[model samples]
Target: MLDEIVASRDAAGAALTAEVDAVIEAANAMSDRFRAGGRLLAFGRGEAAADAAHVAVEFTHPVIVGKRALPALCLGGEPALLGMWGRPQDIAVGICPATGDLAAARSLGLLTVALTANEEFPEADHVLCARSADPLVAREIHITVYHLLWELVHVFQEAE
Candidate 1:
């Protein structure tokens, strides 16, 4: 099982390298939006939701001990919000509802970045499409995508 995981990871890395430019472009776009006083919002379902939460926490609290804060949000933060508000077909609506407890957060201005294996949210400012070949592979790709996005945000913030 371990060997299979390693092999899959290796294959994912290779495939990701081939699409490096697209990844970079997506990251840069997201970074730009984030740097513009726009909070980064991420959401997914099940394990994907867990991944989104992990990505959000990484930005909110850097693991590097001492680092500047980066503004980010996980849509699943409030269970009530998730339950009461119907999921939006588009990410913009999901993250920027006019009413509800999240209205205050949305008023602050946020850019929604949806990470999904499905192409459901077309209106998302930035969508990191998870590779659906394998669950492990998708997780690996999502992690890489998150890191690239964080790096891009760092650079963009530094430049400002």
Candidate 2:
């Protein structure tokens, strides 16, 4: 049991480490959008919907003291409403997206991000794959990725 737990943690760490550069790039872009008056809109289906809500809360109500609360909304995985509310400078985040919503958001001029366990996720401005076959492990990885994004977005803003 201990070995399995360690392996899962290691896998998630390796996946994130491999994608560190991508995360940093995405964070920089996200920071730019926020600076230009963009809000973050997160969505997902089924179990992932909970994660979307969590992301929204994390941004809108920062857990860390001194971290500014950013504007964010959870769309409950509604694709149509994303189009309705998304603006040119807003950020669209899709959790375990299985639809073309991210691509659609991109077309609408919003910066799009997709977090998934699928080997082939739909095209988006930023796609972060958890690289785990197990759903539990993937979920863990996805959670970490979003936390990193939330933290790094602030880091970029502070640096500027």
Candidate 3:
């Protein structure tokens, strides 16, 4: 069990390393949007929904000192109404897998993102693939990814 856990961590590190630069770029873009008064809208299904809420909370109230509290909302249901509240400058992060809202986000001119294990996810301005089929491993990787996002976006915000 210990060896399996170690191997899973290794796999997550390798996958995330390949995507780090893109992740940082996306974070910068998100920071830019936030600076322009754009909020973040995240959503997912079942387990991912919890992460969506978590992401929103993290951005809205960062633990990191001096990190601004960016506006964020997690849509749990009734995705059809997203456009009503969503704005062109907002950012949307679709967690775990696509629930069919990325397209709507794009149509609304919002920045779009998809975080999933599949190579084919909702088309988005950014796609951060967790690259793990195992749920436990994916969760671990996701925690790291979002933590980095929260921290790094602060860096970009400070730079701006």
Candidate 4:
């Protein structure tokens, strides 16, 4: 069982490395918005909704050193609320659902990040494709990805 977890981690790491560049770019964009006094809004459906909230909590209340608190919130799987709350400077992260309409409004200018499976592609400024087939593995990878995002966004935040 331990080996399984280790192997999954190894695979996830490799996959992440392959997409690191795109991740960096998106993080920088997110940081720019944050620096401009924008907020982090995370949304997803079903189980992913909970994950979105978790990500929001981590950002709003950092557990790490040198990472100041940032404005963040979870939409609790509700995309419609975004219509009212989302701004051109905010960043929206959709965990596992279609966000095609999330940024359809041309002037919304919301930096959108969509993490999903290959078959579930959607319109997003950044699309992070998950590499795991098992739900457990996928969840683990998702956690790792968001953790990295939180960390890197701070790095870019410091730059600005």
Which structure among the candidates has the greatest TM-score?
2
For this target, which candidate reaches the highest lDDT against the unseen true structure? 2
Q: What are the lDDT scores of the predictions, listed in order?
A: 0.56, 0.89, 0.81, 0.81
Candidate 2 residue spans exceeding 4 A from truth: 1-5
Deviation from truth (RMSD, Å), model 2: 1.5
Model 1's alpha-carbon lDDT is 0.56
Give the per-residue lDDT digits (tens) of candidate 1, residues 1-160.
9998788778767766776776676666656665555455555455566766777787888776546677666765342343333232212213211224333323334334544454455444445555456776777777777787777667666666
RMSD for each of the candidates: 6.5, 1.5, 1.7, 2.4
lDDT of 3 by residue, 1-160 (tens): 9998788879888999999997898898888888888998877767888888899999998886767788999886445556777899998877775557677778999988777777576467888888887877887777788878888888998886
Show model 1 residue runs off by greater than 4 Å. 1-7, 77-112, 118-121
Off by over 4 Å in 4: 1-9, 99-101, 104-107, 119-122
**Which residue pairs overlap in candidate 2's backbone?**
none
* Poorest stretch of ten by lDDT in candidate 3: 76-85
lDDT tens digits by residue: candidate 4, 101-142: 466422487888877755355468787776877777777777
**Model 3 TM-score, 2 decimals:** 0.91
**Residue pairs of candidate 3 with colliding backbone atoms:** none
What TM-score against the true fold does each predicted structure earn?
0.65, 0.93, 0.91, 0.87
Candidate 2 structure quality by residue, lDDT tens digits, 32-147: 99999999999987799999999999999999999999999999868567788999999999998876768778888999888888757656888888988878888999999999
Q: Local error of candidate 1 at 91, Å? A: 8.7
Q: Per model, how many backbone clashes are there?
A: 0, 0, 0, 0
